[model samples]
Target: MALYKHSAYVKTSTSDEFDKVYSPGASTPHSGIYRCEGCANEIAANQGNPLPPQNHHQHTSAQGSIRWRMIVYAQ
Candidate 1:
Protein backbone atom coordinates (compact mmCIF):
# COMPACT_ATOMS: atom_id res chain seq x y z
CA MET A 1 0.00 0.00 0.00
CA ALA A 2 1.19 3.50 -0.84
CA LEU A 3 1.43 5.85 2.08
CA TYR A 4 0.03 9.30 1.45
CA LYS A 5 0.02 12.10 4.00
CA HIS A 6 -2.15 14.63 2.21
CA SER A 7 -5.91 14.82 1.79
CA ALA A 8 -8.23 17.05 -0.16
CA TYR A 9 -11.92 17.65 -0.64
CA VAL A 10 -13.40 16.66 -3.96
CA LYS A 11 -16.23 18.44 -5.74
CA THR A 12 -16.69 16.07 -8.59
CA SER A 13 -19.28 14.02 -10.41
CA THR A 14 -19.08 10.33 -11.18
CA SER A 15 -21.00 8.05 -13.51
CA ASP A 16 -19.81 4.70 -12.17
CA GLU A 17 -22.75 2.87 -10.71
CA PHE A 18 -22.53 1.22 -7.33
CA ASP A 19 -24.14 -2.14 -6.82
CA LYS A 20 -26.80 -2.56 -4.21
CA VAL A 21 -25.49 -3.70 -0.84
CA TYR A 22 -26.99 -4.98 2.37
CA SER A 23 -25.97 -5.00 5.98
CA PRO A 24 -24.41 -8.22 7.35
CA GLY A 25 -27.79 -9.53 8.35
CA ALA A 26 -29.75 -7.76 5.69
CA SER A 27 -29.14 -10.23 2.87
CA THR A 28 -30.29 -13.80 2.61
CA PRO A 29 -27.12 -15.86 2.88
CA HIS A 30 -26.64 -19.19 1.18
CA SER A 31 -24.53 -22.33 1.49
CA GLY A 32 -21.73 -20.65 -0.46
CA ILE A 33 -20.00 -17.31 -0.65
CA TYR A 34 -21.03 -14.47 -2.90
CA ARG A 35 -18.73 -11.94 -4.48
CA CYS A 36 -19.31 -8.58 -6.06
CA GLU A 37 -18.37 -8.22 -9.71
CA GLY A 38 -17.95 -4.48 -9.67
CA CYS A 39 -15.51 -4.13 -6.75
CA ALA A 40 -14.71 -7.72 -5.88
CA ASN A 41 -16.27 -7.38 -2.47
CA GLU A 42 -17.38 -10.58 -0.88
CA ILE A 43 -20.27 -11.70 1.22
CA ALA A 44 -19.65 -14.66 3.49
CA ALA A 45 -22.73 -16.68 2.71
CA ASN A 46 -21.44 -19.51 4.90
CA GLN A 47 -21.92 -17.36 7.97
CA GLY A 48 -25.55 -18.34 7.89
CA ASN A 49 -28.52 -16.56 6.34
CA PRO A 50 -28.12 -12.82 6.32
CA LEU A 51 -24.45 -13.34 7.26
CA PRO A 52 -22.98 -11.56 10.25
CA PRO A 53 -23.16 -7.79 9.81
CA GLN A 54 -20.10 -6.09 8.35
CA ASN A 55 -18.90 -2.62 7.53
CA HIS A 56 -19.29 -1.37 4.00
CA HIS A 57 -15.64 -0.48 3.51
CA GLN A 58 -14.31 -3.60 5.15
CA HIS A 59 -13.83 -5.60 1.96
CA THR A 60 -12.89 -2.69 -0.28
CA SER A 61 -9.92 -0.51 -0.98
CA ALA A 62 -9.77 3.25 -0.69
CA GLN A 63 -8.75 5.03 -3.89
CA GLY A 64 -7.78 8.64 -4.40
CA SER A 65 -4.93 10.85 -5.49
CA ILE A 66 -3.20 13.50 -3.45
CA ARG A 67 -1.93 16.02 -5.96
CA TRP A 68 -1.32 19.70 -5.93
CA ARG A 69 -3.57 21.60 -8.29
CA MET A 70 -1.93 24.92 -7.48
CA ILE A 71 1.78 24.88 -6.86
CA VAL A 72 3.25 28.34 -6.53
CA TYR A 73 6.46 28.67 -8.45
CA ALA A 74 8.57 31.77 -9.08
CA GLN A 75 6.11 34.60 -9.69
Candidate 2:
Protein backbone atom coordinates (compact mmCIF):
# COMPACT_ATOMS: atom_id res chain seq x y z
CA MET A 1 0.00 0.00 0.00
CA ALA A 2 1.08 3.63 -0.58
CA LEU A 3 2.16 5.37 2.59
CA TYR A 4 2.44 9.03 3.60
CA LYS A 5 2.93 10.83 6.90
CA HIS A 6 1.13 14.10 6.18
CA SER A 7 -2.56 13.82 5.42
CA ALA A 8 -2.54 17.38 4.07
CA TYR A 9 -0.50 16.19 1.10
CA VAL A 10 -2.97 13.46 0.08
CA LYS A 11 -6.67 13.07 -0.60
CA THR A 12 -9.16 10.53 -1.96
CA SER A 13 -11.31 10.40 -5.11
CA THR A 14 -14.09 8.27 -6.61
CA SER A 15 -12.77 8.02 -10.14
CA ASP A 16 -13.78 4.98 -12.23
CA GLU A 17 -10.19 4.70 -13.46
CA PHE A 18 -9.44 2.86 -10.26
CA ASP A 19 -11.62 -0.03 -11.40
CA LYS A 20 -9.79 -0.58 -14.66
CA VAL A 21 -7.06 -3.18 -15.27
CA TYR A 22 -4.15 -2.75 -17.67
CA SER A 23 -1.80 -5.03 -19.56
CA PRO A 24 1.97 -5.00 -19.45
CA GLY A 25 3.64 -2.30 -21.59
CA ALA A 26 0.34 -0.46 -21.93
CA SER A 27 0.07 3.28 -21.41
CA THR A 28 -1.02 4.26 -17.93
CA PRO A 29 -4.29 6.21 -17.67
CA HIS A 30 -3.24 7.92 -14.47
CA SER A 31 -0.25 8.40 -12.18
CA GLY A 32 -0.56 6.20 -9.16
CA ILE A 33 0.37 2.98 -7.39
CA TYR A 34 -0.58 -0.06 -9.46
CA ARG A 35 -0.99 -3.56 -8.02
CA CYS A 36 -0.39 -6.69 -9.99
CA GLU A 37 -3.44 -8.95 -10.12
CA GLY A 38 -1.34 -12.08 -10.42
CA CYS A 39 1.08 -11.70 -7.54
CA ALA A 40 -0.12 -8.61 -5.75
CA ASN A 41 3.13 -6.74 -6.44
CA GLU A 42 2.92 -2.96 -6.72
CA ILE A 43 4.54 -0.32 -8.94
CA ALA A 44 4.36 3.44 -9.30
CA ALA A 45 3.57 4.62 -12.81
CA ASN A 46 2.86 7.92 -14.52
CA GLN A 47 0.10 8.74 -16.99
CA GLY A 48 1.01 8.25 -20.69
CA ASN A 49 4.03 6.09 -19.74
CA PRO A 50 4.19 2.43 -20.59
CA LEU A 51 3.66 0.05 -17.72
CA PRO A 52 6.31 -2.53 -16.82
CA PRO A 53 6.90 -5.21 -19.40
CA GLN A 54 5.91 -8.84 -18.93
CA ASN A 55 9.55 -9.63 -18.19
CA HIS A 56 9.54 -7.17 -15.31
CA HIS A 57 8.77 -10.06 -12.98
CA GLN A 58 8.14 -13.76 -12.88
CA HIS A 59 4.95 -15.56 -12.06
CA THR A 60 3.92 -19.15 -11.56
CA SER A 61 1.16 -20.70 -13.63
CA ALA A 62 -1.07 -20.38 -10.59
CA GLN A 63 -0.20 -16.73 -10.12
CA GLY A 64 -1.53 -15.99 -13.62
CA SER A 65 -0.75 -12.88 -15.73
CA ILE A 66 0.89 -9.59 -14.76
CA ARG A 67 -2.21 -7.45 -14.92
CA TRP A 68 -2.12 -4.01 -13.28
CA ARG A 69 -4.77 -2.04 -11.43
CA MET A 70 -4.44 1.42 -9.93
CA ILE A 71 -4.90 1.45 -6.19
CA VAL A 72 -3.65 4.90 -5.31
CA TYR A 73 -4.17 8.06 -7.35
CA ALA A 74 -1.59 10.82 -7.60
CA GLN A 75 -2.63 14.20 -8.84
Candidate 3:
Protein backbone atom coordinates (compact mmCIF):
# COMPACT_ATOMS: atom_id res chain seq x y z
CA MET A 1 0.00 0.00 0.00
CA ALA A 2 1.13 3.56 -0.61
CA LEU A 3 1.41 5.84 2.40
CA TYR A 4 -0.17 9.20 1.64
CA LYS A 5 0.62 12.39 3.55
CA HIS A 6 -0.49 16.01 3.27
CA SER A 7 1.38 19.26 3.86
CA ALA A 8 1.48 21.06 7.22
CA TYR A 9 2.22 24.59 6.09
CA VAL A 10 -0.93 24.54 4.01
CA LYS A 11 -2.85 24.08 7.20
CA THR A 12 -1.19 27.16 8.68
CA SER A 13 -1.94 29.52 5.85
CA THR A 14 -4.03 32.52 6.93
CA SER A 15 -5.25 32.98 3.39
CA ASP A 16 -7.78 30.80 1.60
CA GLU A 17 -5.69 30.65 -1.58
CA PHE A 18 -4.40 27.22 -0.68
CA ASP A 19 -7.91 25.96 -0.23
CA LYS A 20 -8.85 27.46 -3.56
CA VAL A 21 -5.88 25.84 -5.26
CA TYR A 22 -5.88 22.36 -3.78
CA SER A 23 -9.63 21.89 -3.24
CA PRO A 24 -8.77 18.82 -1.19
CA GLY A 25 -11.13 15.90 -1.46
CA ALA A 26 -14.05 15.38 0.88
CA SER A 27 -11.96 12.90 2.87
CA THR A 28 -9.30 15.56 3.29
CA PRO A 29 -9.46 17.51 6.53
CA HIS A 30 -10.25 21.25 6.36
CA SER A 31 -7.20 22.56 8.15
CA GLY A 32 -4.56 25.19 7.31
CA ILE A 33 -1.82 24.98 4.72
CA TYR A 34 1.86 24.26 5.25
CA ARG A 35 4.67 25.75 3.20
CA CYS A 36 6.82 23.13 1.50
CA GLU A 37 10.44 24.09 1.84
CA GLY A 38 11.47 21.71 -0.90
CA CYS A 39 9.17 22.62 -3.77
CA ALA A 40 8.32 26.18 -2.78
CA ASN A 41 4.70 25.23 -3.17
CA GLU A 42 1.69 25.90 -1.01
CA ILE A 43 0.49 22.83 0.85
CA ALA A 44 -3.19 22.03 0.61
CA ALA A 45 -5.50 22.67 3.51
CA ASN A 46 -6.83 19.97 5.91
CA GLN A 47 -4.40 17.35 4.64
CA GLY A 48 -2.02 15.45 6.87
CA ASN A 49 1.71 16.18 7.36
CA PRO A 50 2.24 17.02 3.64
CA LEU A 51 5.26 14.83 3.24
CA PRO A 52 6.45 13.30 0.01
CA PRO A 53 5.18 9.95 -1.15
CA GLN A 54 7.01 6.98 0.33
CA ASN A 55 8.43 5.96 -3.04
CA HIS A 56 9.91 9.40 -3.62
CA HIS A 57 13.34 10.54 -2.38
CA GLN A 58 13.16 12.78 0.68
CA HIS A 59 15.67 15.09 2.28
CA THR A 60 17.29 13.76 5.43
CA SER A 61 19.55 15.51 7.90
CA ALA A 62 21.68 14.41 10.85
CA GLN A 63 19.28 16.00 13.27
CA GLY A 64 16.16 14.59 11.75
CA SER A 65 14.15 14.65 8.50
CA ILE A 66 12.83 17.62 6.60
CA ARG A 67 9.38 17.55 5.02
CA TRP A 68 10.33 17.94 1.36
CA ARG A 69 7.30 16.83 -0.60
CA MET A 70 5.68 17.75 -3.90
CA ILE A 71 2.57 19.94 -3.90
CA VAL A 72 -0.48 18.51 -5.62
CA TYR A 73 -2.93 21.17 -6.70
CA ALA A 74 -6.46 20.69 -7.95
CA GLN A 75 -6.73 21.13 -11.70
Estimate TM-scores for all models.
0.28, 0.88, 0.25
1 or 2, which is superior by TM-score? Answer: 2
Q: Give each model's whole-structure lDDT.
A: 0.34, 0.92, 0.36
1-75 per-residue lDDT for model 2 (tens digits): 667899998778888988899999999999989999999899999999999999999999999889999999888
Q: For residue 57, what is the lDDT in candidate 2?
A: 98
The 10-residue segment of model 1 with minimum total lDDT is: 66-75
Q: Output the better candidate (1/3) by lDDT.
A: 3
Q: Which candidate is the best by TM-score?
A: 2
Q: Could you give candidate 1's per-residue lDDT for residues 23-75 as a string of tens digits?
A: 44544423434444334444444323454444344443443211111111111
List RMSD in Å for every model shown: 17.5, 1.2, 11.9
Q: 1 or 3, which is superior by TM-score?
A: 1
Candidate numbers, best lDDT first, in rank order? 2, 3, 1
lDDT digits (tens) for residues 1-75 of candidate 3: 112476642233244443432221223333433344543444444445433343333444642332332233332
